[model samples]
Structure formats: structure tokens, C-alpha cells
Target: MKEELLATFSNHFEKPLIDEIMEEGRLMEVPAGETIMDIGQYIRSMPLLLSGAIKVLREDEEGDELLLYYLEQGETCSVTMACCMGQTKSEIRAIAETDSRLVMVPVQKMEEWMAKYKGWRNYVFESYQNRLNELLQTVDSIAFKNLDQRLVDYLKKKVEVTNDNQIRNTHQEIAYDLHTSRVVVSRLLKKLEKMKKLELHRNYIQIVNL
Candidate 1:
């Protein structure tokens, strides 16, 4: 586990900090589609992704969800870090996008390490900046891009994160992520199919031109 931590995070964290993580962090496995954290929950630990992907989302009062960003291997959710630092409830939901392994670092250690380790502070700050940029990109897409174009971009990102051209998400699931009605998603997907950009199957969408 220590070796895994070092191999995945050594570039951003020092050996001593990694040693502490190995000692203090709890390793866990989360299956695909599992809700690891939900809105309004008090965050007790911060996750360090070891493998696979986790998608962070925000929900409206009506329960529609919007994809915020993905946490891939060697990445952590800055929103969760913020909740940890502030000792506040989570404002975003984190769901496993694929079967995943991660180390859950207790919230108490987060502050201790931030004050004790320069590398930890740098990692935290960089994560916040990266997440902010991603949020900006999402806002820009919603503000300027058409629904079809946003759907295409969303599909491309899913392919990149899973490293597969085939997306297993159902149309309704995709609708929820994009914060749209299933009918709208299906219509756009069909349009994309007719355009020869992708192929729609019973349970998955296969990327061709996209």
C-alpha cells in the first residue's frame, strides 16, 4: 500500500507525508455507481484516488444533477477537501464512475499535514485551482454550447476517463448527469446517431466519429 501511494502520488507529496498517509489513511474499495458521499453529509475523510474514476456532481432543489468533474487516478476531490477544512457538510455528491480503490485520509490529519508539510499545501492548492478551472469550463459549456455539442463533449470526456470508446451509461443516467430530461437526451443521441457520430445500442453508446 505504501508503494502504491508512493508510485501514484510521489510527484506531489514527499516521502514523509506519504508515510503518514499510509499510516493514517484507510484503504477502501467502492464499486461502480456507488454513492460514496452525498450532499448534506458531513465529510469525515478526504479520498485519494488509487485507481478508476469518481464523478463529482451538484444537485438542484428539484433533484436534477450536474456533473462537476471527475476524480481520476492520482487525483482528489477539492470540494471534499474544502468541506474537510471548513468542518462543514458536503455540497457535492461523489459517485464511483468505475470500480475504484482509494485511501481515505481522516479530516483531522488534513489540517495537521497542511501546516506541517509544504508539499501537502501545494497539492491542496493545485487541486483547488484545477477544480475551479473545470467548474469554469462546465459553466462555459452550459452558457455558450448547444445541448448537442455539450452532449458530445460530455461523451468524449466519459470516453477519456474510462479509456474506452464504449460508454455503458443509459440515456436516463446521462440525462441526470447533464441535468436534462431523458426525452431530450434520447432525441439528441438519436440525432447524433443519424449524423454518424456514434452508434446507440441497447445498453451502451459506442463512439465512432466522436
Candidate 2:
């Protein structure tokens, strides 16, 4: 576990620092569909994703959630860093998009590392920049794009993230992600099928192109 964890963190950290962090961290596996962080949960640790994928979503006061972005291999949840730094509660949710393995770094080390470790500091800043850009893009998609275009983009993104053309989710699930109703998603999907953009199966969507 240490060896693989070390290898996973290598892109952002040196061996010595990785070893130190490993001493303070514990590697854990998250199952598919499991929630890693929930709204209002205390920020105890930040996870370093080693394998598989995670979907980060933001919830509104109405308890409605919209997909913010994805964090897969070689990525960390930046919002967790914010909560860790300020001793605040989590404002977003993280769910395992696939069975994923990650190392949980205690919140104490997070602050100290930012002040003390160059690698850690660089990682935090990079994560913040990356996630903010993703969120901005999400906003742009929602505000400027039509529902069909957004649905098309969403399918392409799911394929890119999961490396699977066959998206194993129901129309209701897709609607939830898109913040629409099942009937609307079903209608658009039929339109996409007529356009030969994709093929729909029971509880799944197979993208033929785009």
C-alpha cells in the first residue's frame, strides 16, 4: 500500500514527504455509490485519489445537488482543503463514481504541510485552481447551453471520466445530474437516438459518437 501510495503521490510530492505523509495517512477503499463527504460533515481529512473516480456535487439550501466536477486519479478535492483550513463544515458532497482507493490525510497535517512542505503547498494551490476552473465551466454550461447540448456534453464527459461508452445509469439519474425531469431527459434521449448520437439500453446509454 505504501509503495503504490508513494507512486500515486509522486507527481506532486517527493519520496521523503510522501513517506512522512503516509505515516500520518491511512489508505481506504470507497465502494461505488458511497458518499465520502456529505454537507455539514466536519472536515477531518482530505483524500488523495489513487484509482477510480469521484463525483463532486454541490447542494443548495433546498437540498438539490448538481454535479460540480469529477476527481479521478491524481486529483484531490479542493473544497475539502478549504474546510480543513478554516475548521468549517463541508459545503459539498463527494461520492465514489467507481470503486476507488485513496489515502486520507489528517486535517492537522494539511495546515502544517501548506506552511512547511513545498510539495504540499503546490498541490493545494493547483487543486484550487483546477476545481475552480471546472466549476466555472459547469456554470457556463448551465447558463449558456441548451438542454440537448448540455446532455450531449454530459454523456461525452461521463465517457471520458469512466472510460466506458456504456453509461450505467437510468434516465432519472441522468435527469438528476442535469437538474431536470425524467420526462425531459427521456424526450431528449429519444431525439439523440433519432440523430444517431447514441443508443439507449435498459438503464444504460451507449454513445455511438459524441
Candidate 3:
């Protein structure tokens, strides 16, 4: 699993460094719907996702979860922020969306690896920069793009991977990704379905246009 996690960073670093990092890491399994990291709990290690997905969510005073971001396979958690700031607690909860395999490494071990391996350090730095760039892009899109535009753009990107006009997704899942309410996504999807642009099944939305 650690080998698979390191493969995601393969393009950013040398094979030797990736091997070393994996060698020093340990694997952990997280069950679906479980908290990988709870809000207000200290994160002593970083978890590199090897399989499955996780969601970063914020809880309100009333205990309602607001989706912040989603972590796919090959992505690492934001535990680095807590480690760097020496924070004793986190404000966000990392919840596993599916049964997940993670490559965990202690902060001290990560620091030691960075000191000993230049490639490893560079890879981590690049990962942070890439994540920051993604967040900035999301902010820009939300600020300037309307919901329809955003949804269309998202479908286009998904179509590239799916290689078909059809997509499998739910209104709730789309809302989570779009950082909007389910009612909003449902309303917009209804319009799209009426237009024959897609079909809404029991729990999945299928796009009909390429």
C-alpha cells in the first residue's frame, strides 16, 4: 500500500527516494464512515492515502457537517499543517468515505527523512504547493463562475476520465464536491434533466451529452 501511495509522487521525485519513504512508513486501515482525524484531536502523524477516499469537513455548533474538500486515492492528509504549527487540535474532521488504506509516518520520522533525502523534501514541498494551487483554483471558480458553469466544467473533466457521456454521481455527492446544499444541486439537476442533458436515476446522475 505504501508503494502505491509513493507512486502518486513518482513524477515529482526519484524512485530511490520514494522507496525510502515507503520503507519508513506503516500501513493503516480506516473503515468507511469513520473519523480518520477528529476535530479537536492532535494529529501526530501524516496519512498518505493508498486506496479509497476521505472528506475534509467542518462541523457547526449544531453539529452539521459542511464539506470542505475531498481526498482521493494517492492524496495525503493535511496533517502537515498541524505538525508545522505545533497545533494540539484540528478544526476539521477527516472522514473516510470508503474503506481506506493509508501509509502513516510519524512527524519525527518524516522530518528525519526530509533531512536525509533531498528528493523527498522537494516532493513534499511540491505536494503542498500543488494542493494550495488547487484550493486557489476552487476559490476562483466559486467566485467567478455560476453554478451551471461550474457543473458543466466538472462534467467535462469527469467525461475525460469516464470516456463516455454517462456519469455516475448523486446529488448529495455533487453538492459535497461543489460545497453547496443538496437542495441547490437537486434543483439544478432537475433543470438539467428536464432539458434532456442528463438522466437522474435512483441515486445516480447520468450525463447524456459528451
Best by lDDT: 1
Model 1: how far residue 157 lies from native, Å: 0.5
- Tens-digit lDDT string for candidate 1 (82-169): 9998999999999999999999999999999989999999999999999999999999999999998899999999998999999999
Tens-place lDDT digits, model 3, residues 134-195: 66766778889998878777776555533456556667766766767889988988888888
C-alpha TM-scores of all predictions? 0.98, 0.96, 0.74
- Model 2: C-alpha RMSD to truth? 1.1
Better of 1 and 3 by TM-score: 1
TM-score of candidate 1 against the unseen true structure: 0.98
Whole-model Cα lDDT of every candidate shown, in order: 0.94, 0.88, 0.71
lDDT of 2 by residue, 79-162 (tens): 888898889999988999889999899988888887878998898899999999998999999999999999998898889889
The order by descending lDDT is 1, 2, 3
Q: Score residue 89 of candidate 3 by CA lDDT.
A: 77
Clash number for each model: 0, 0, 0
Of 2 and 3, the candidate ranking higher by TM-score: 2
Between which residue pairs do clashes occur in model 1? none
lDDT of 3 at 140: 78
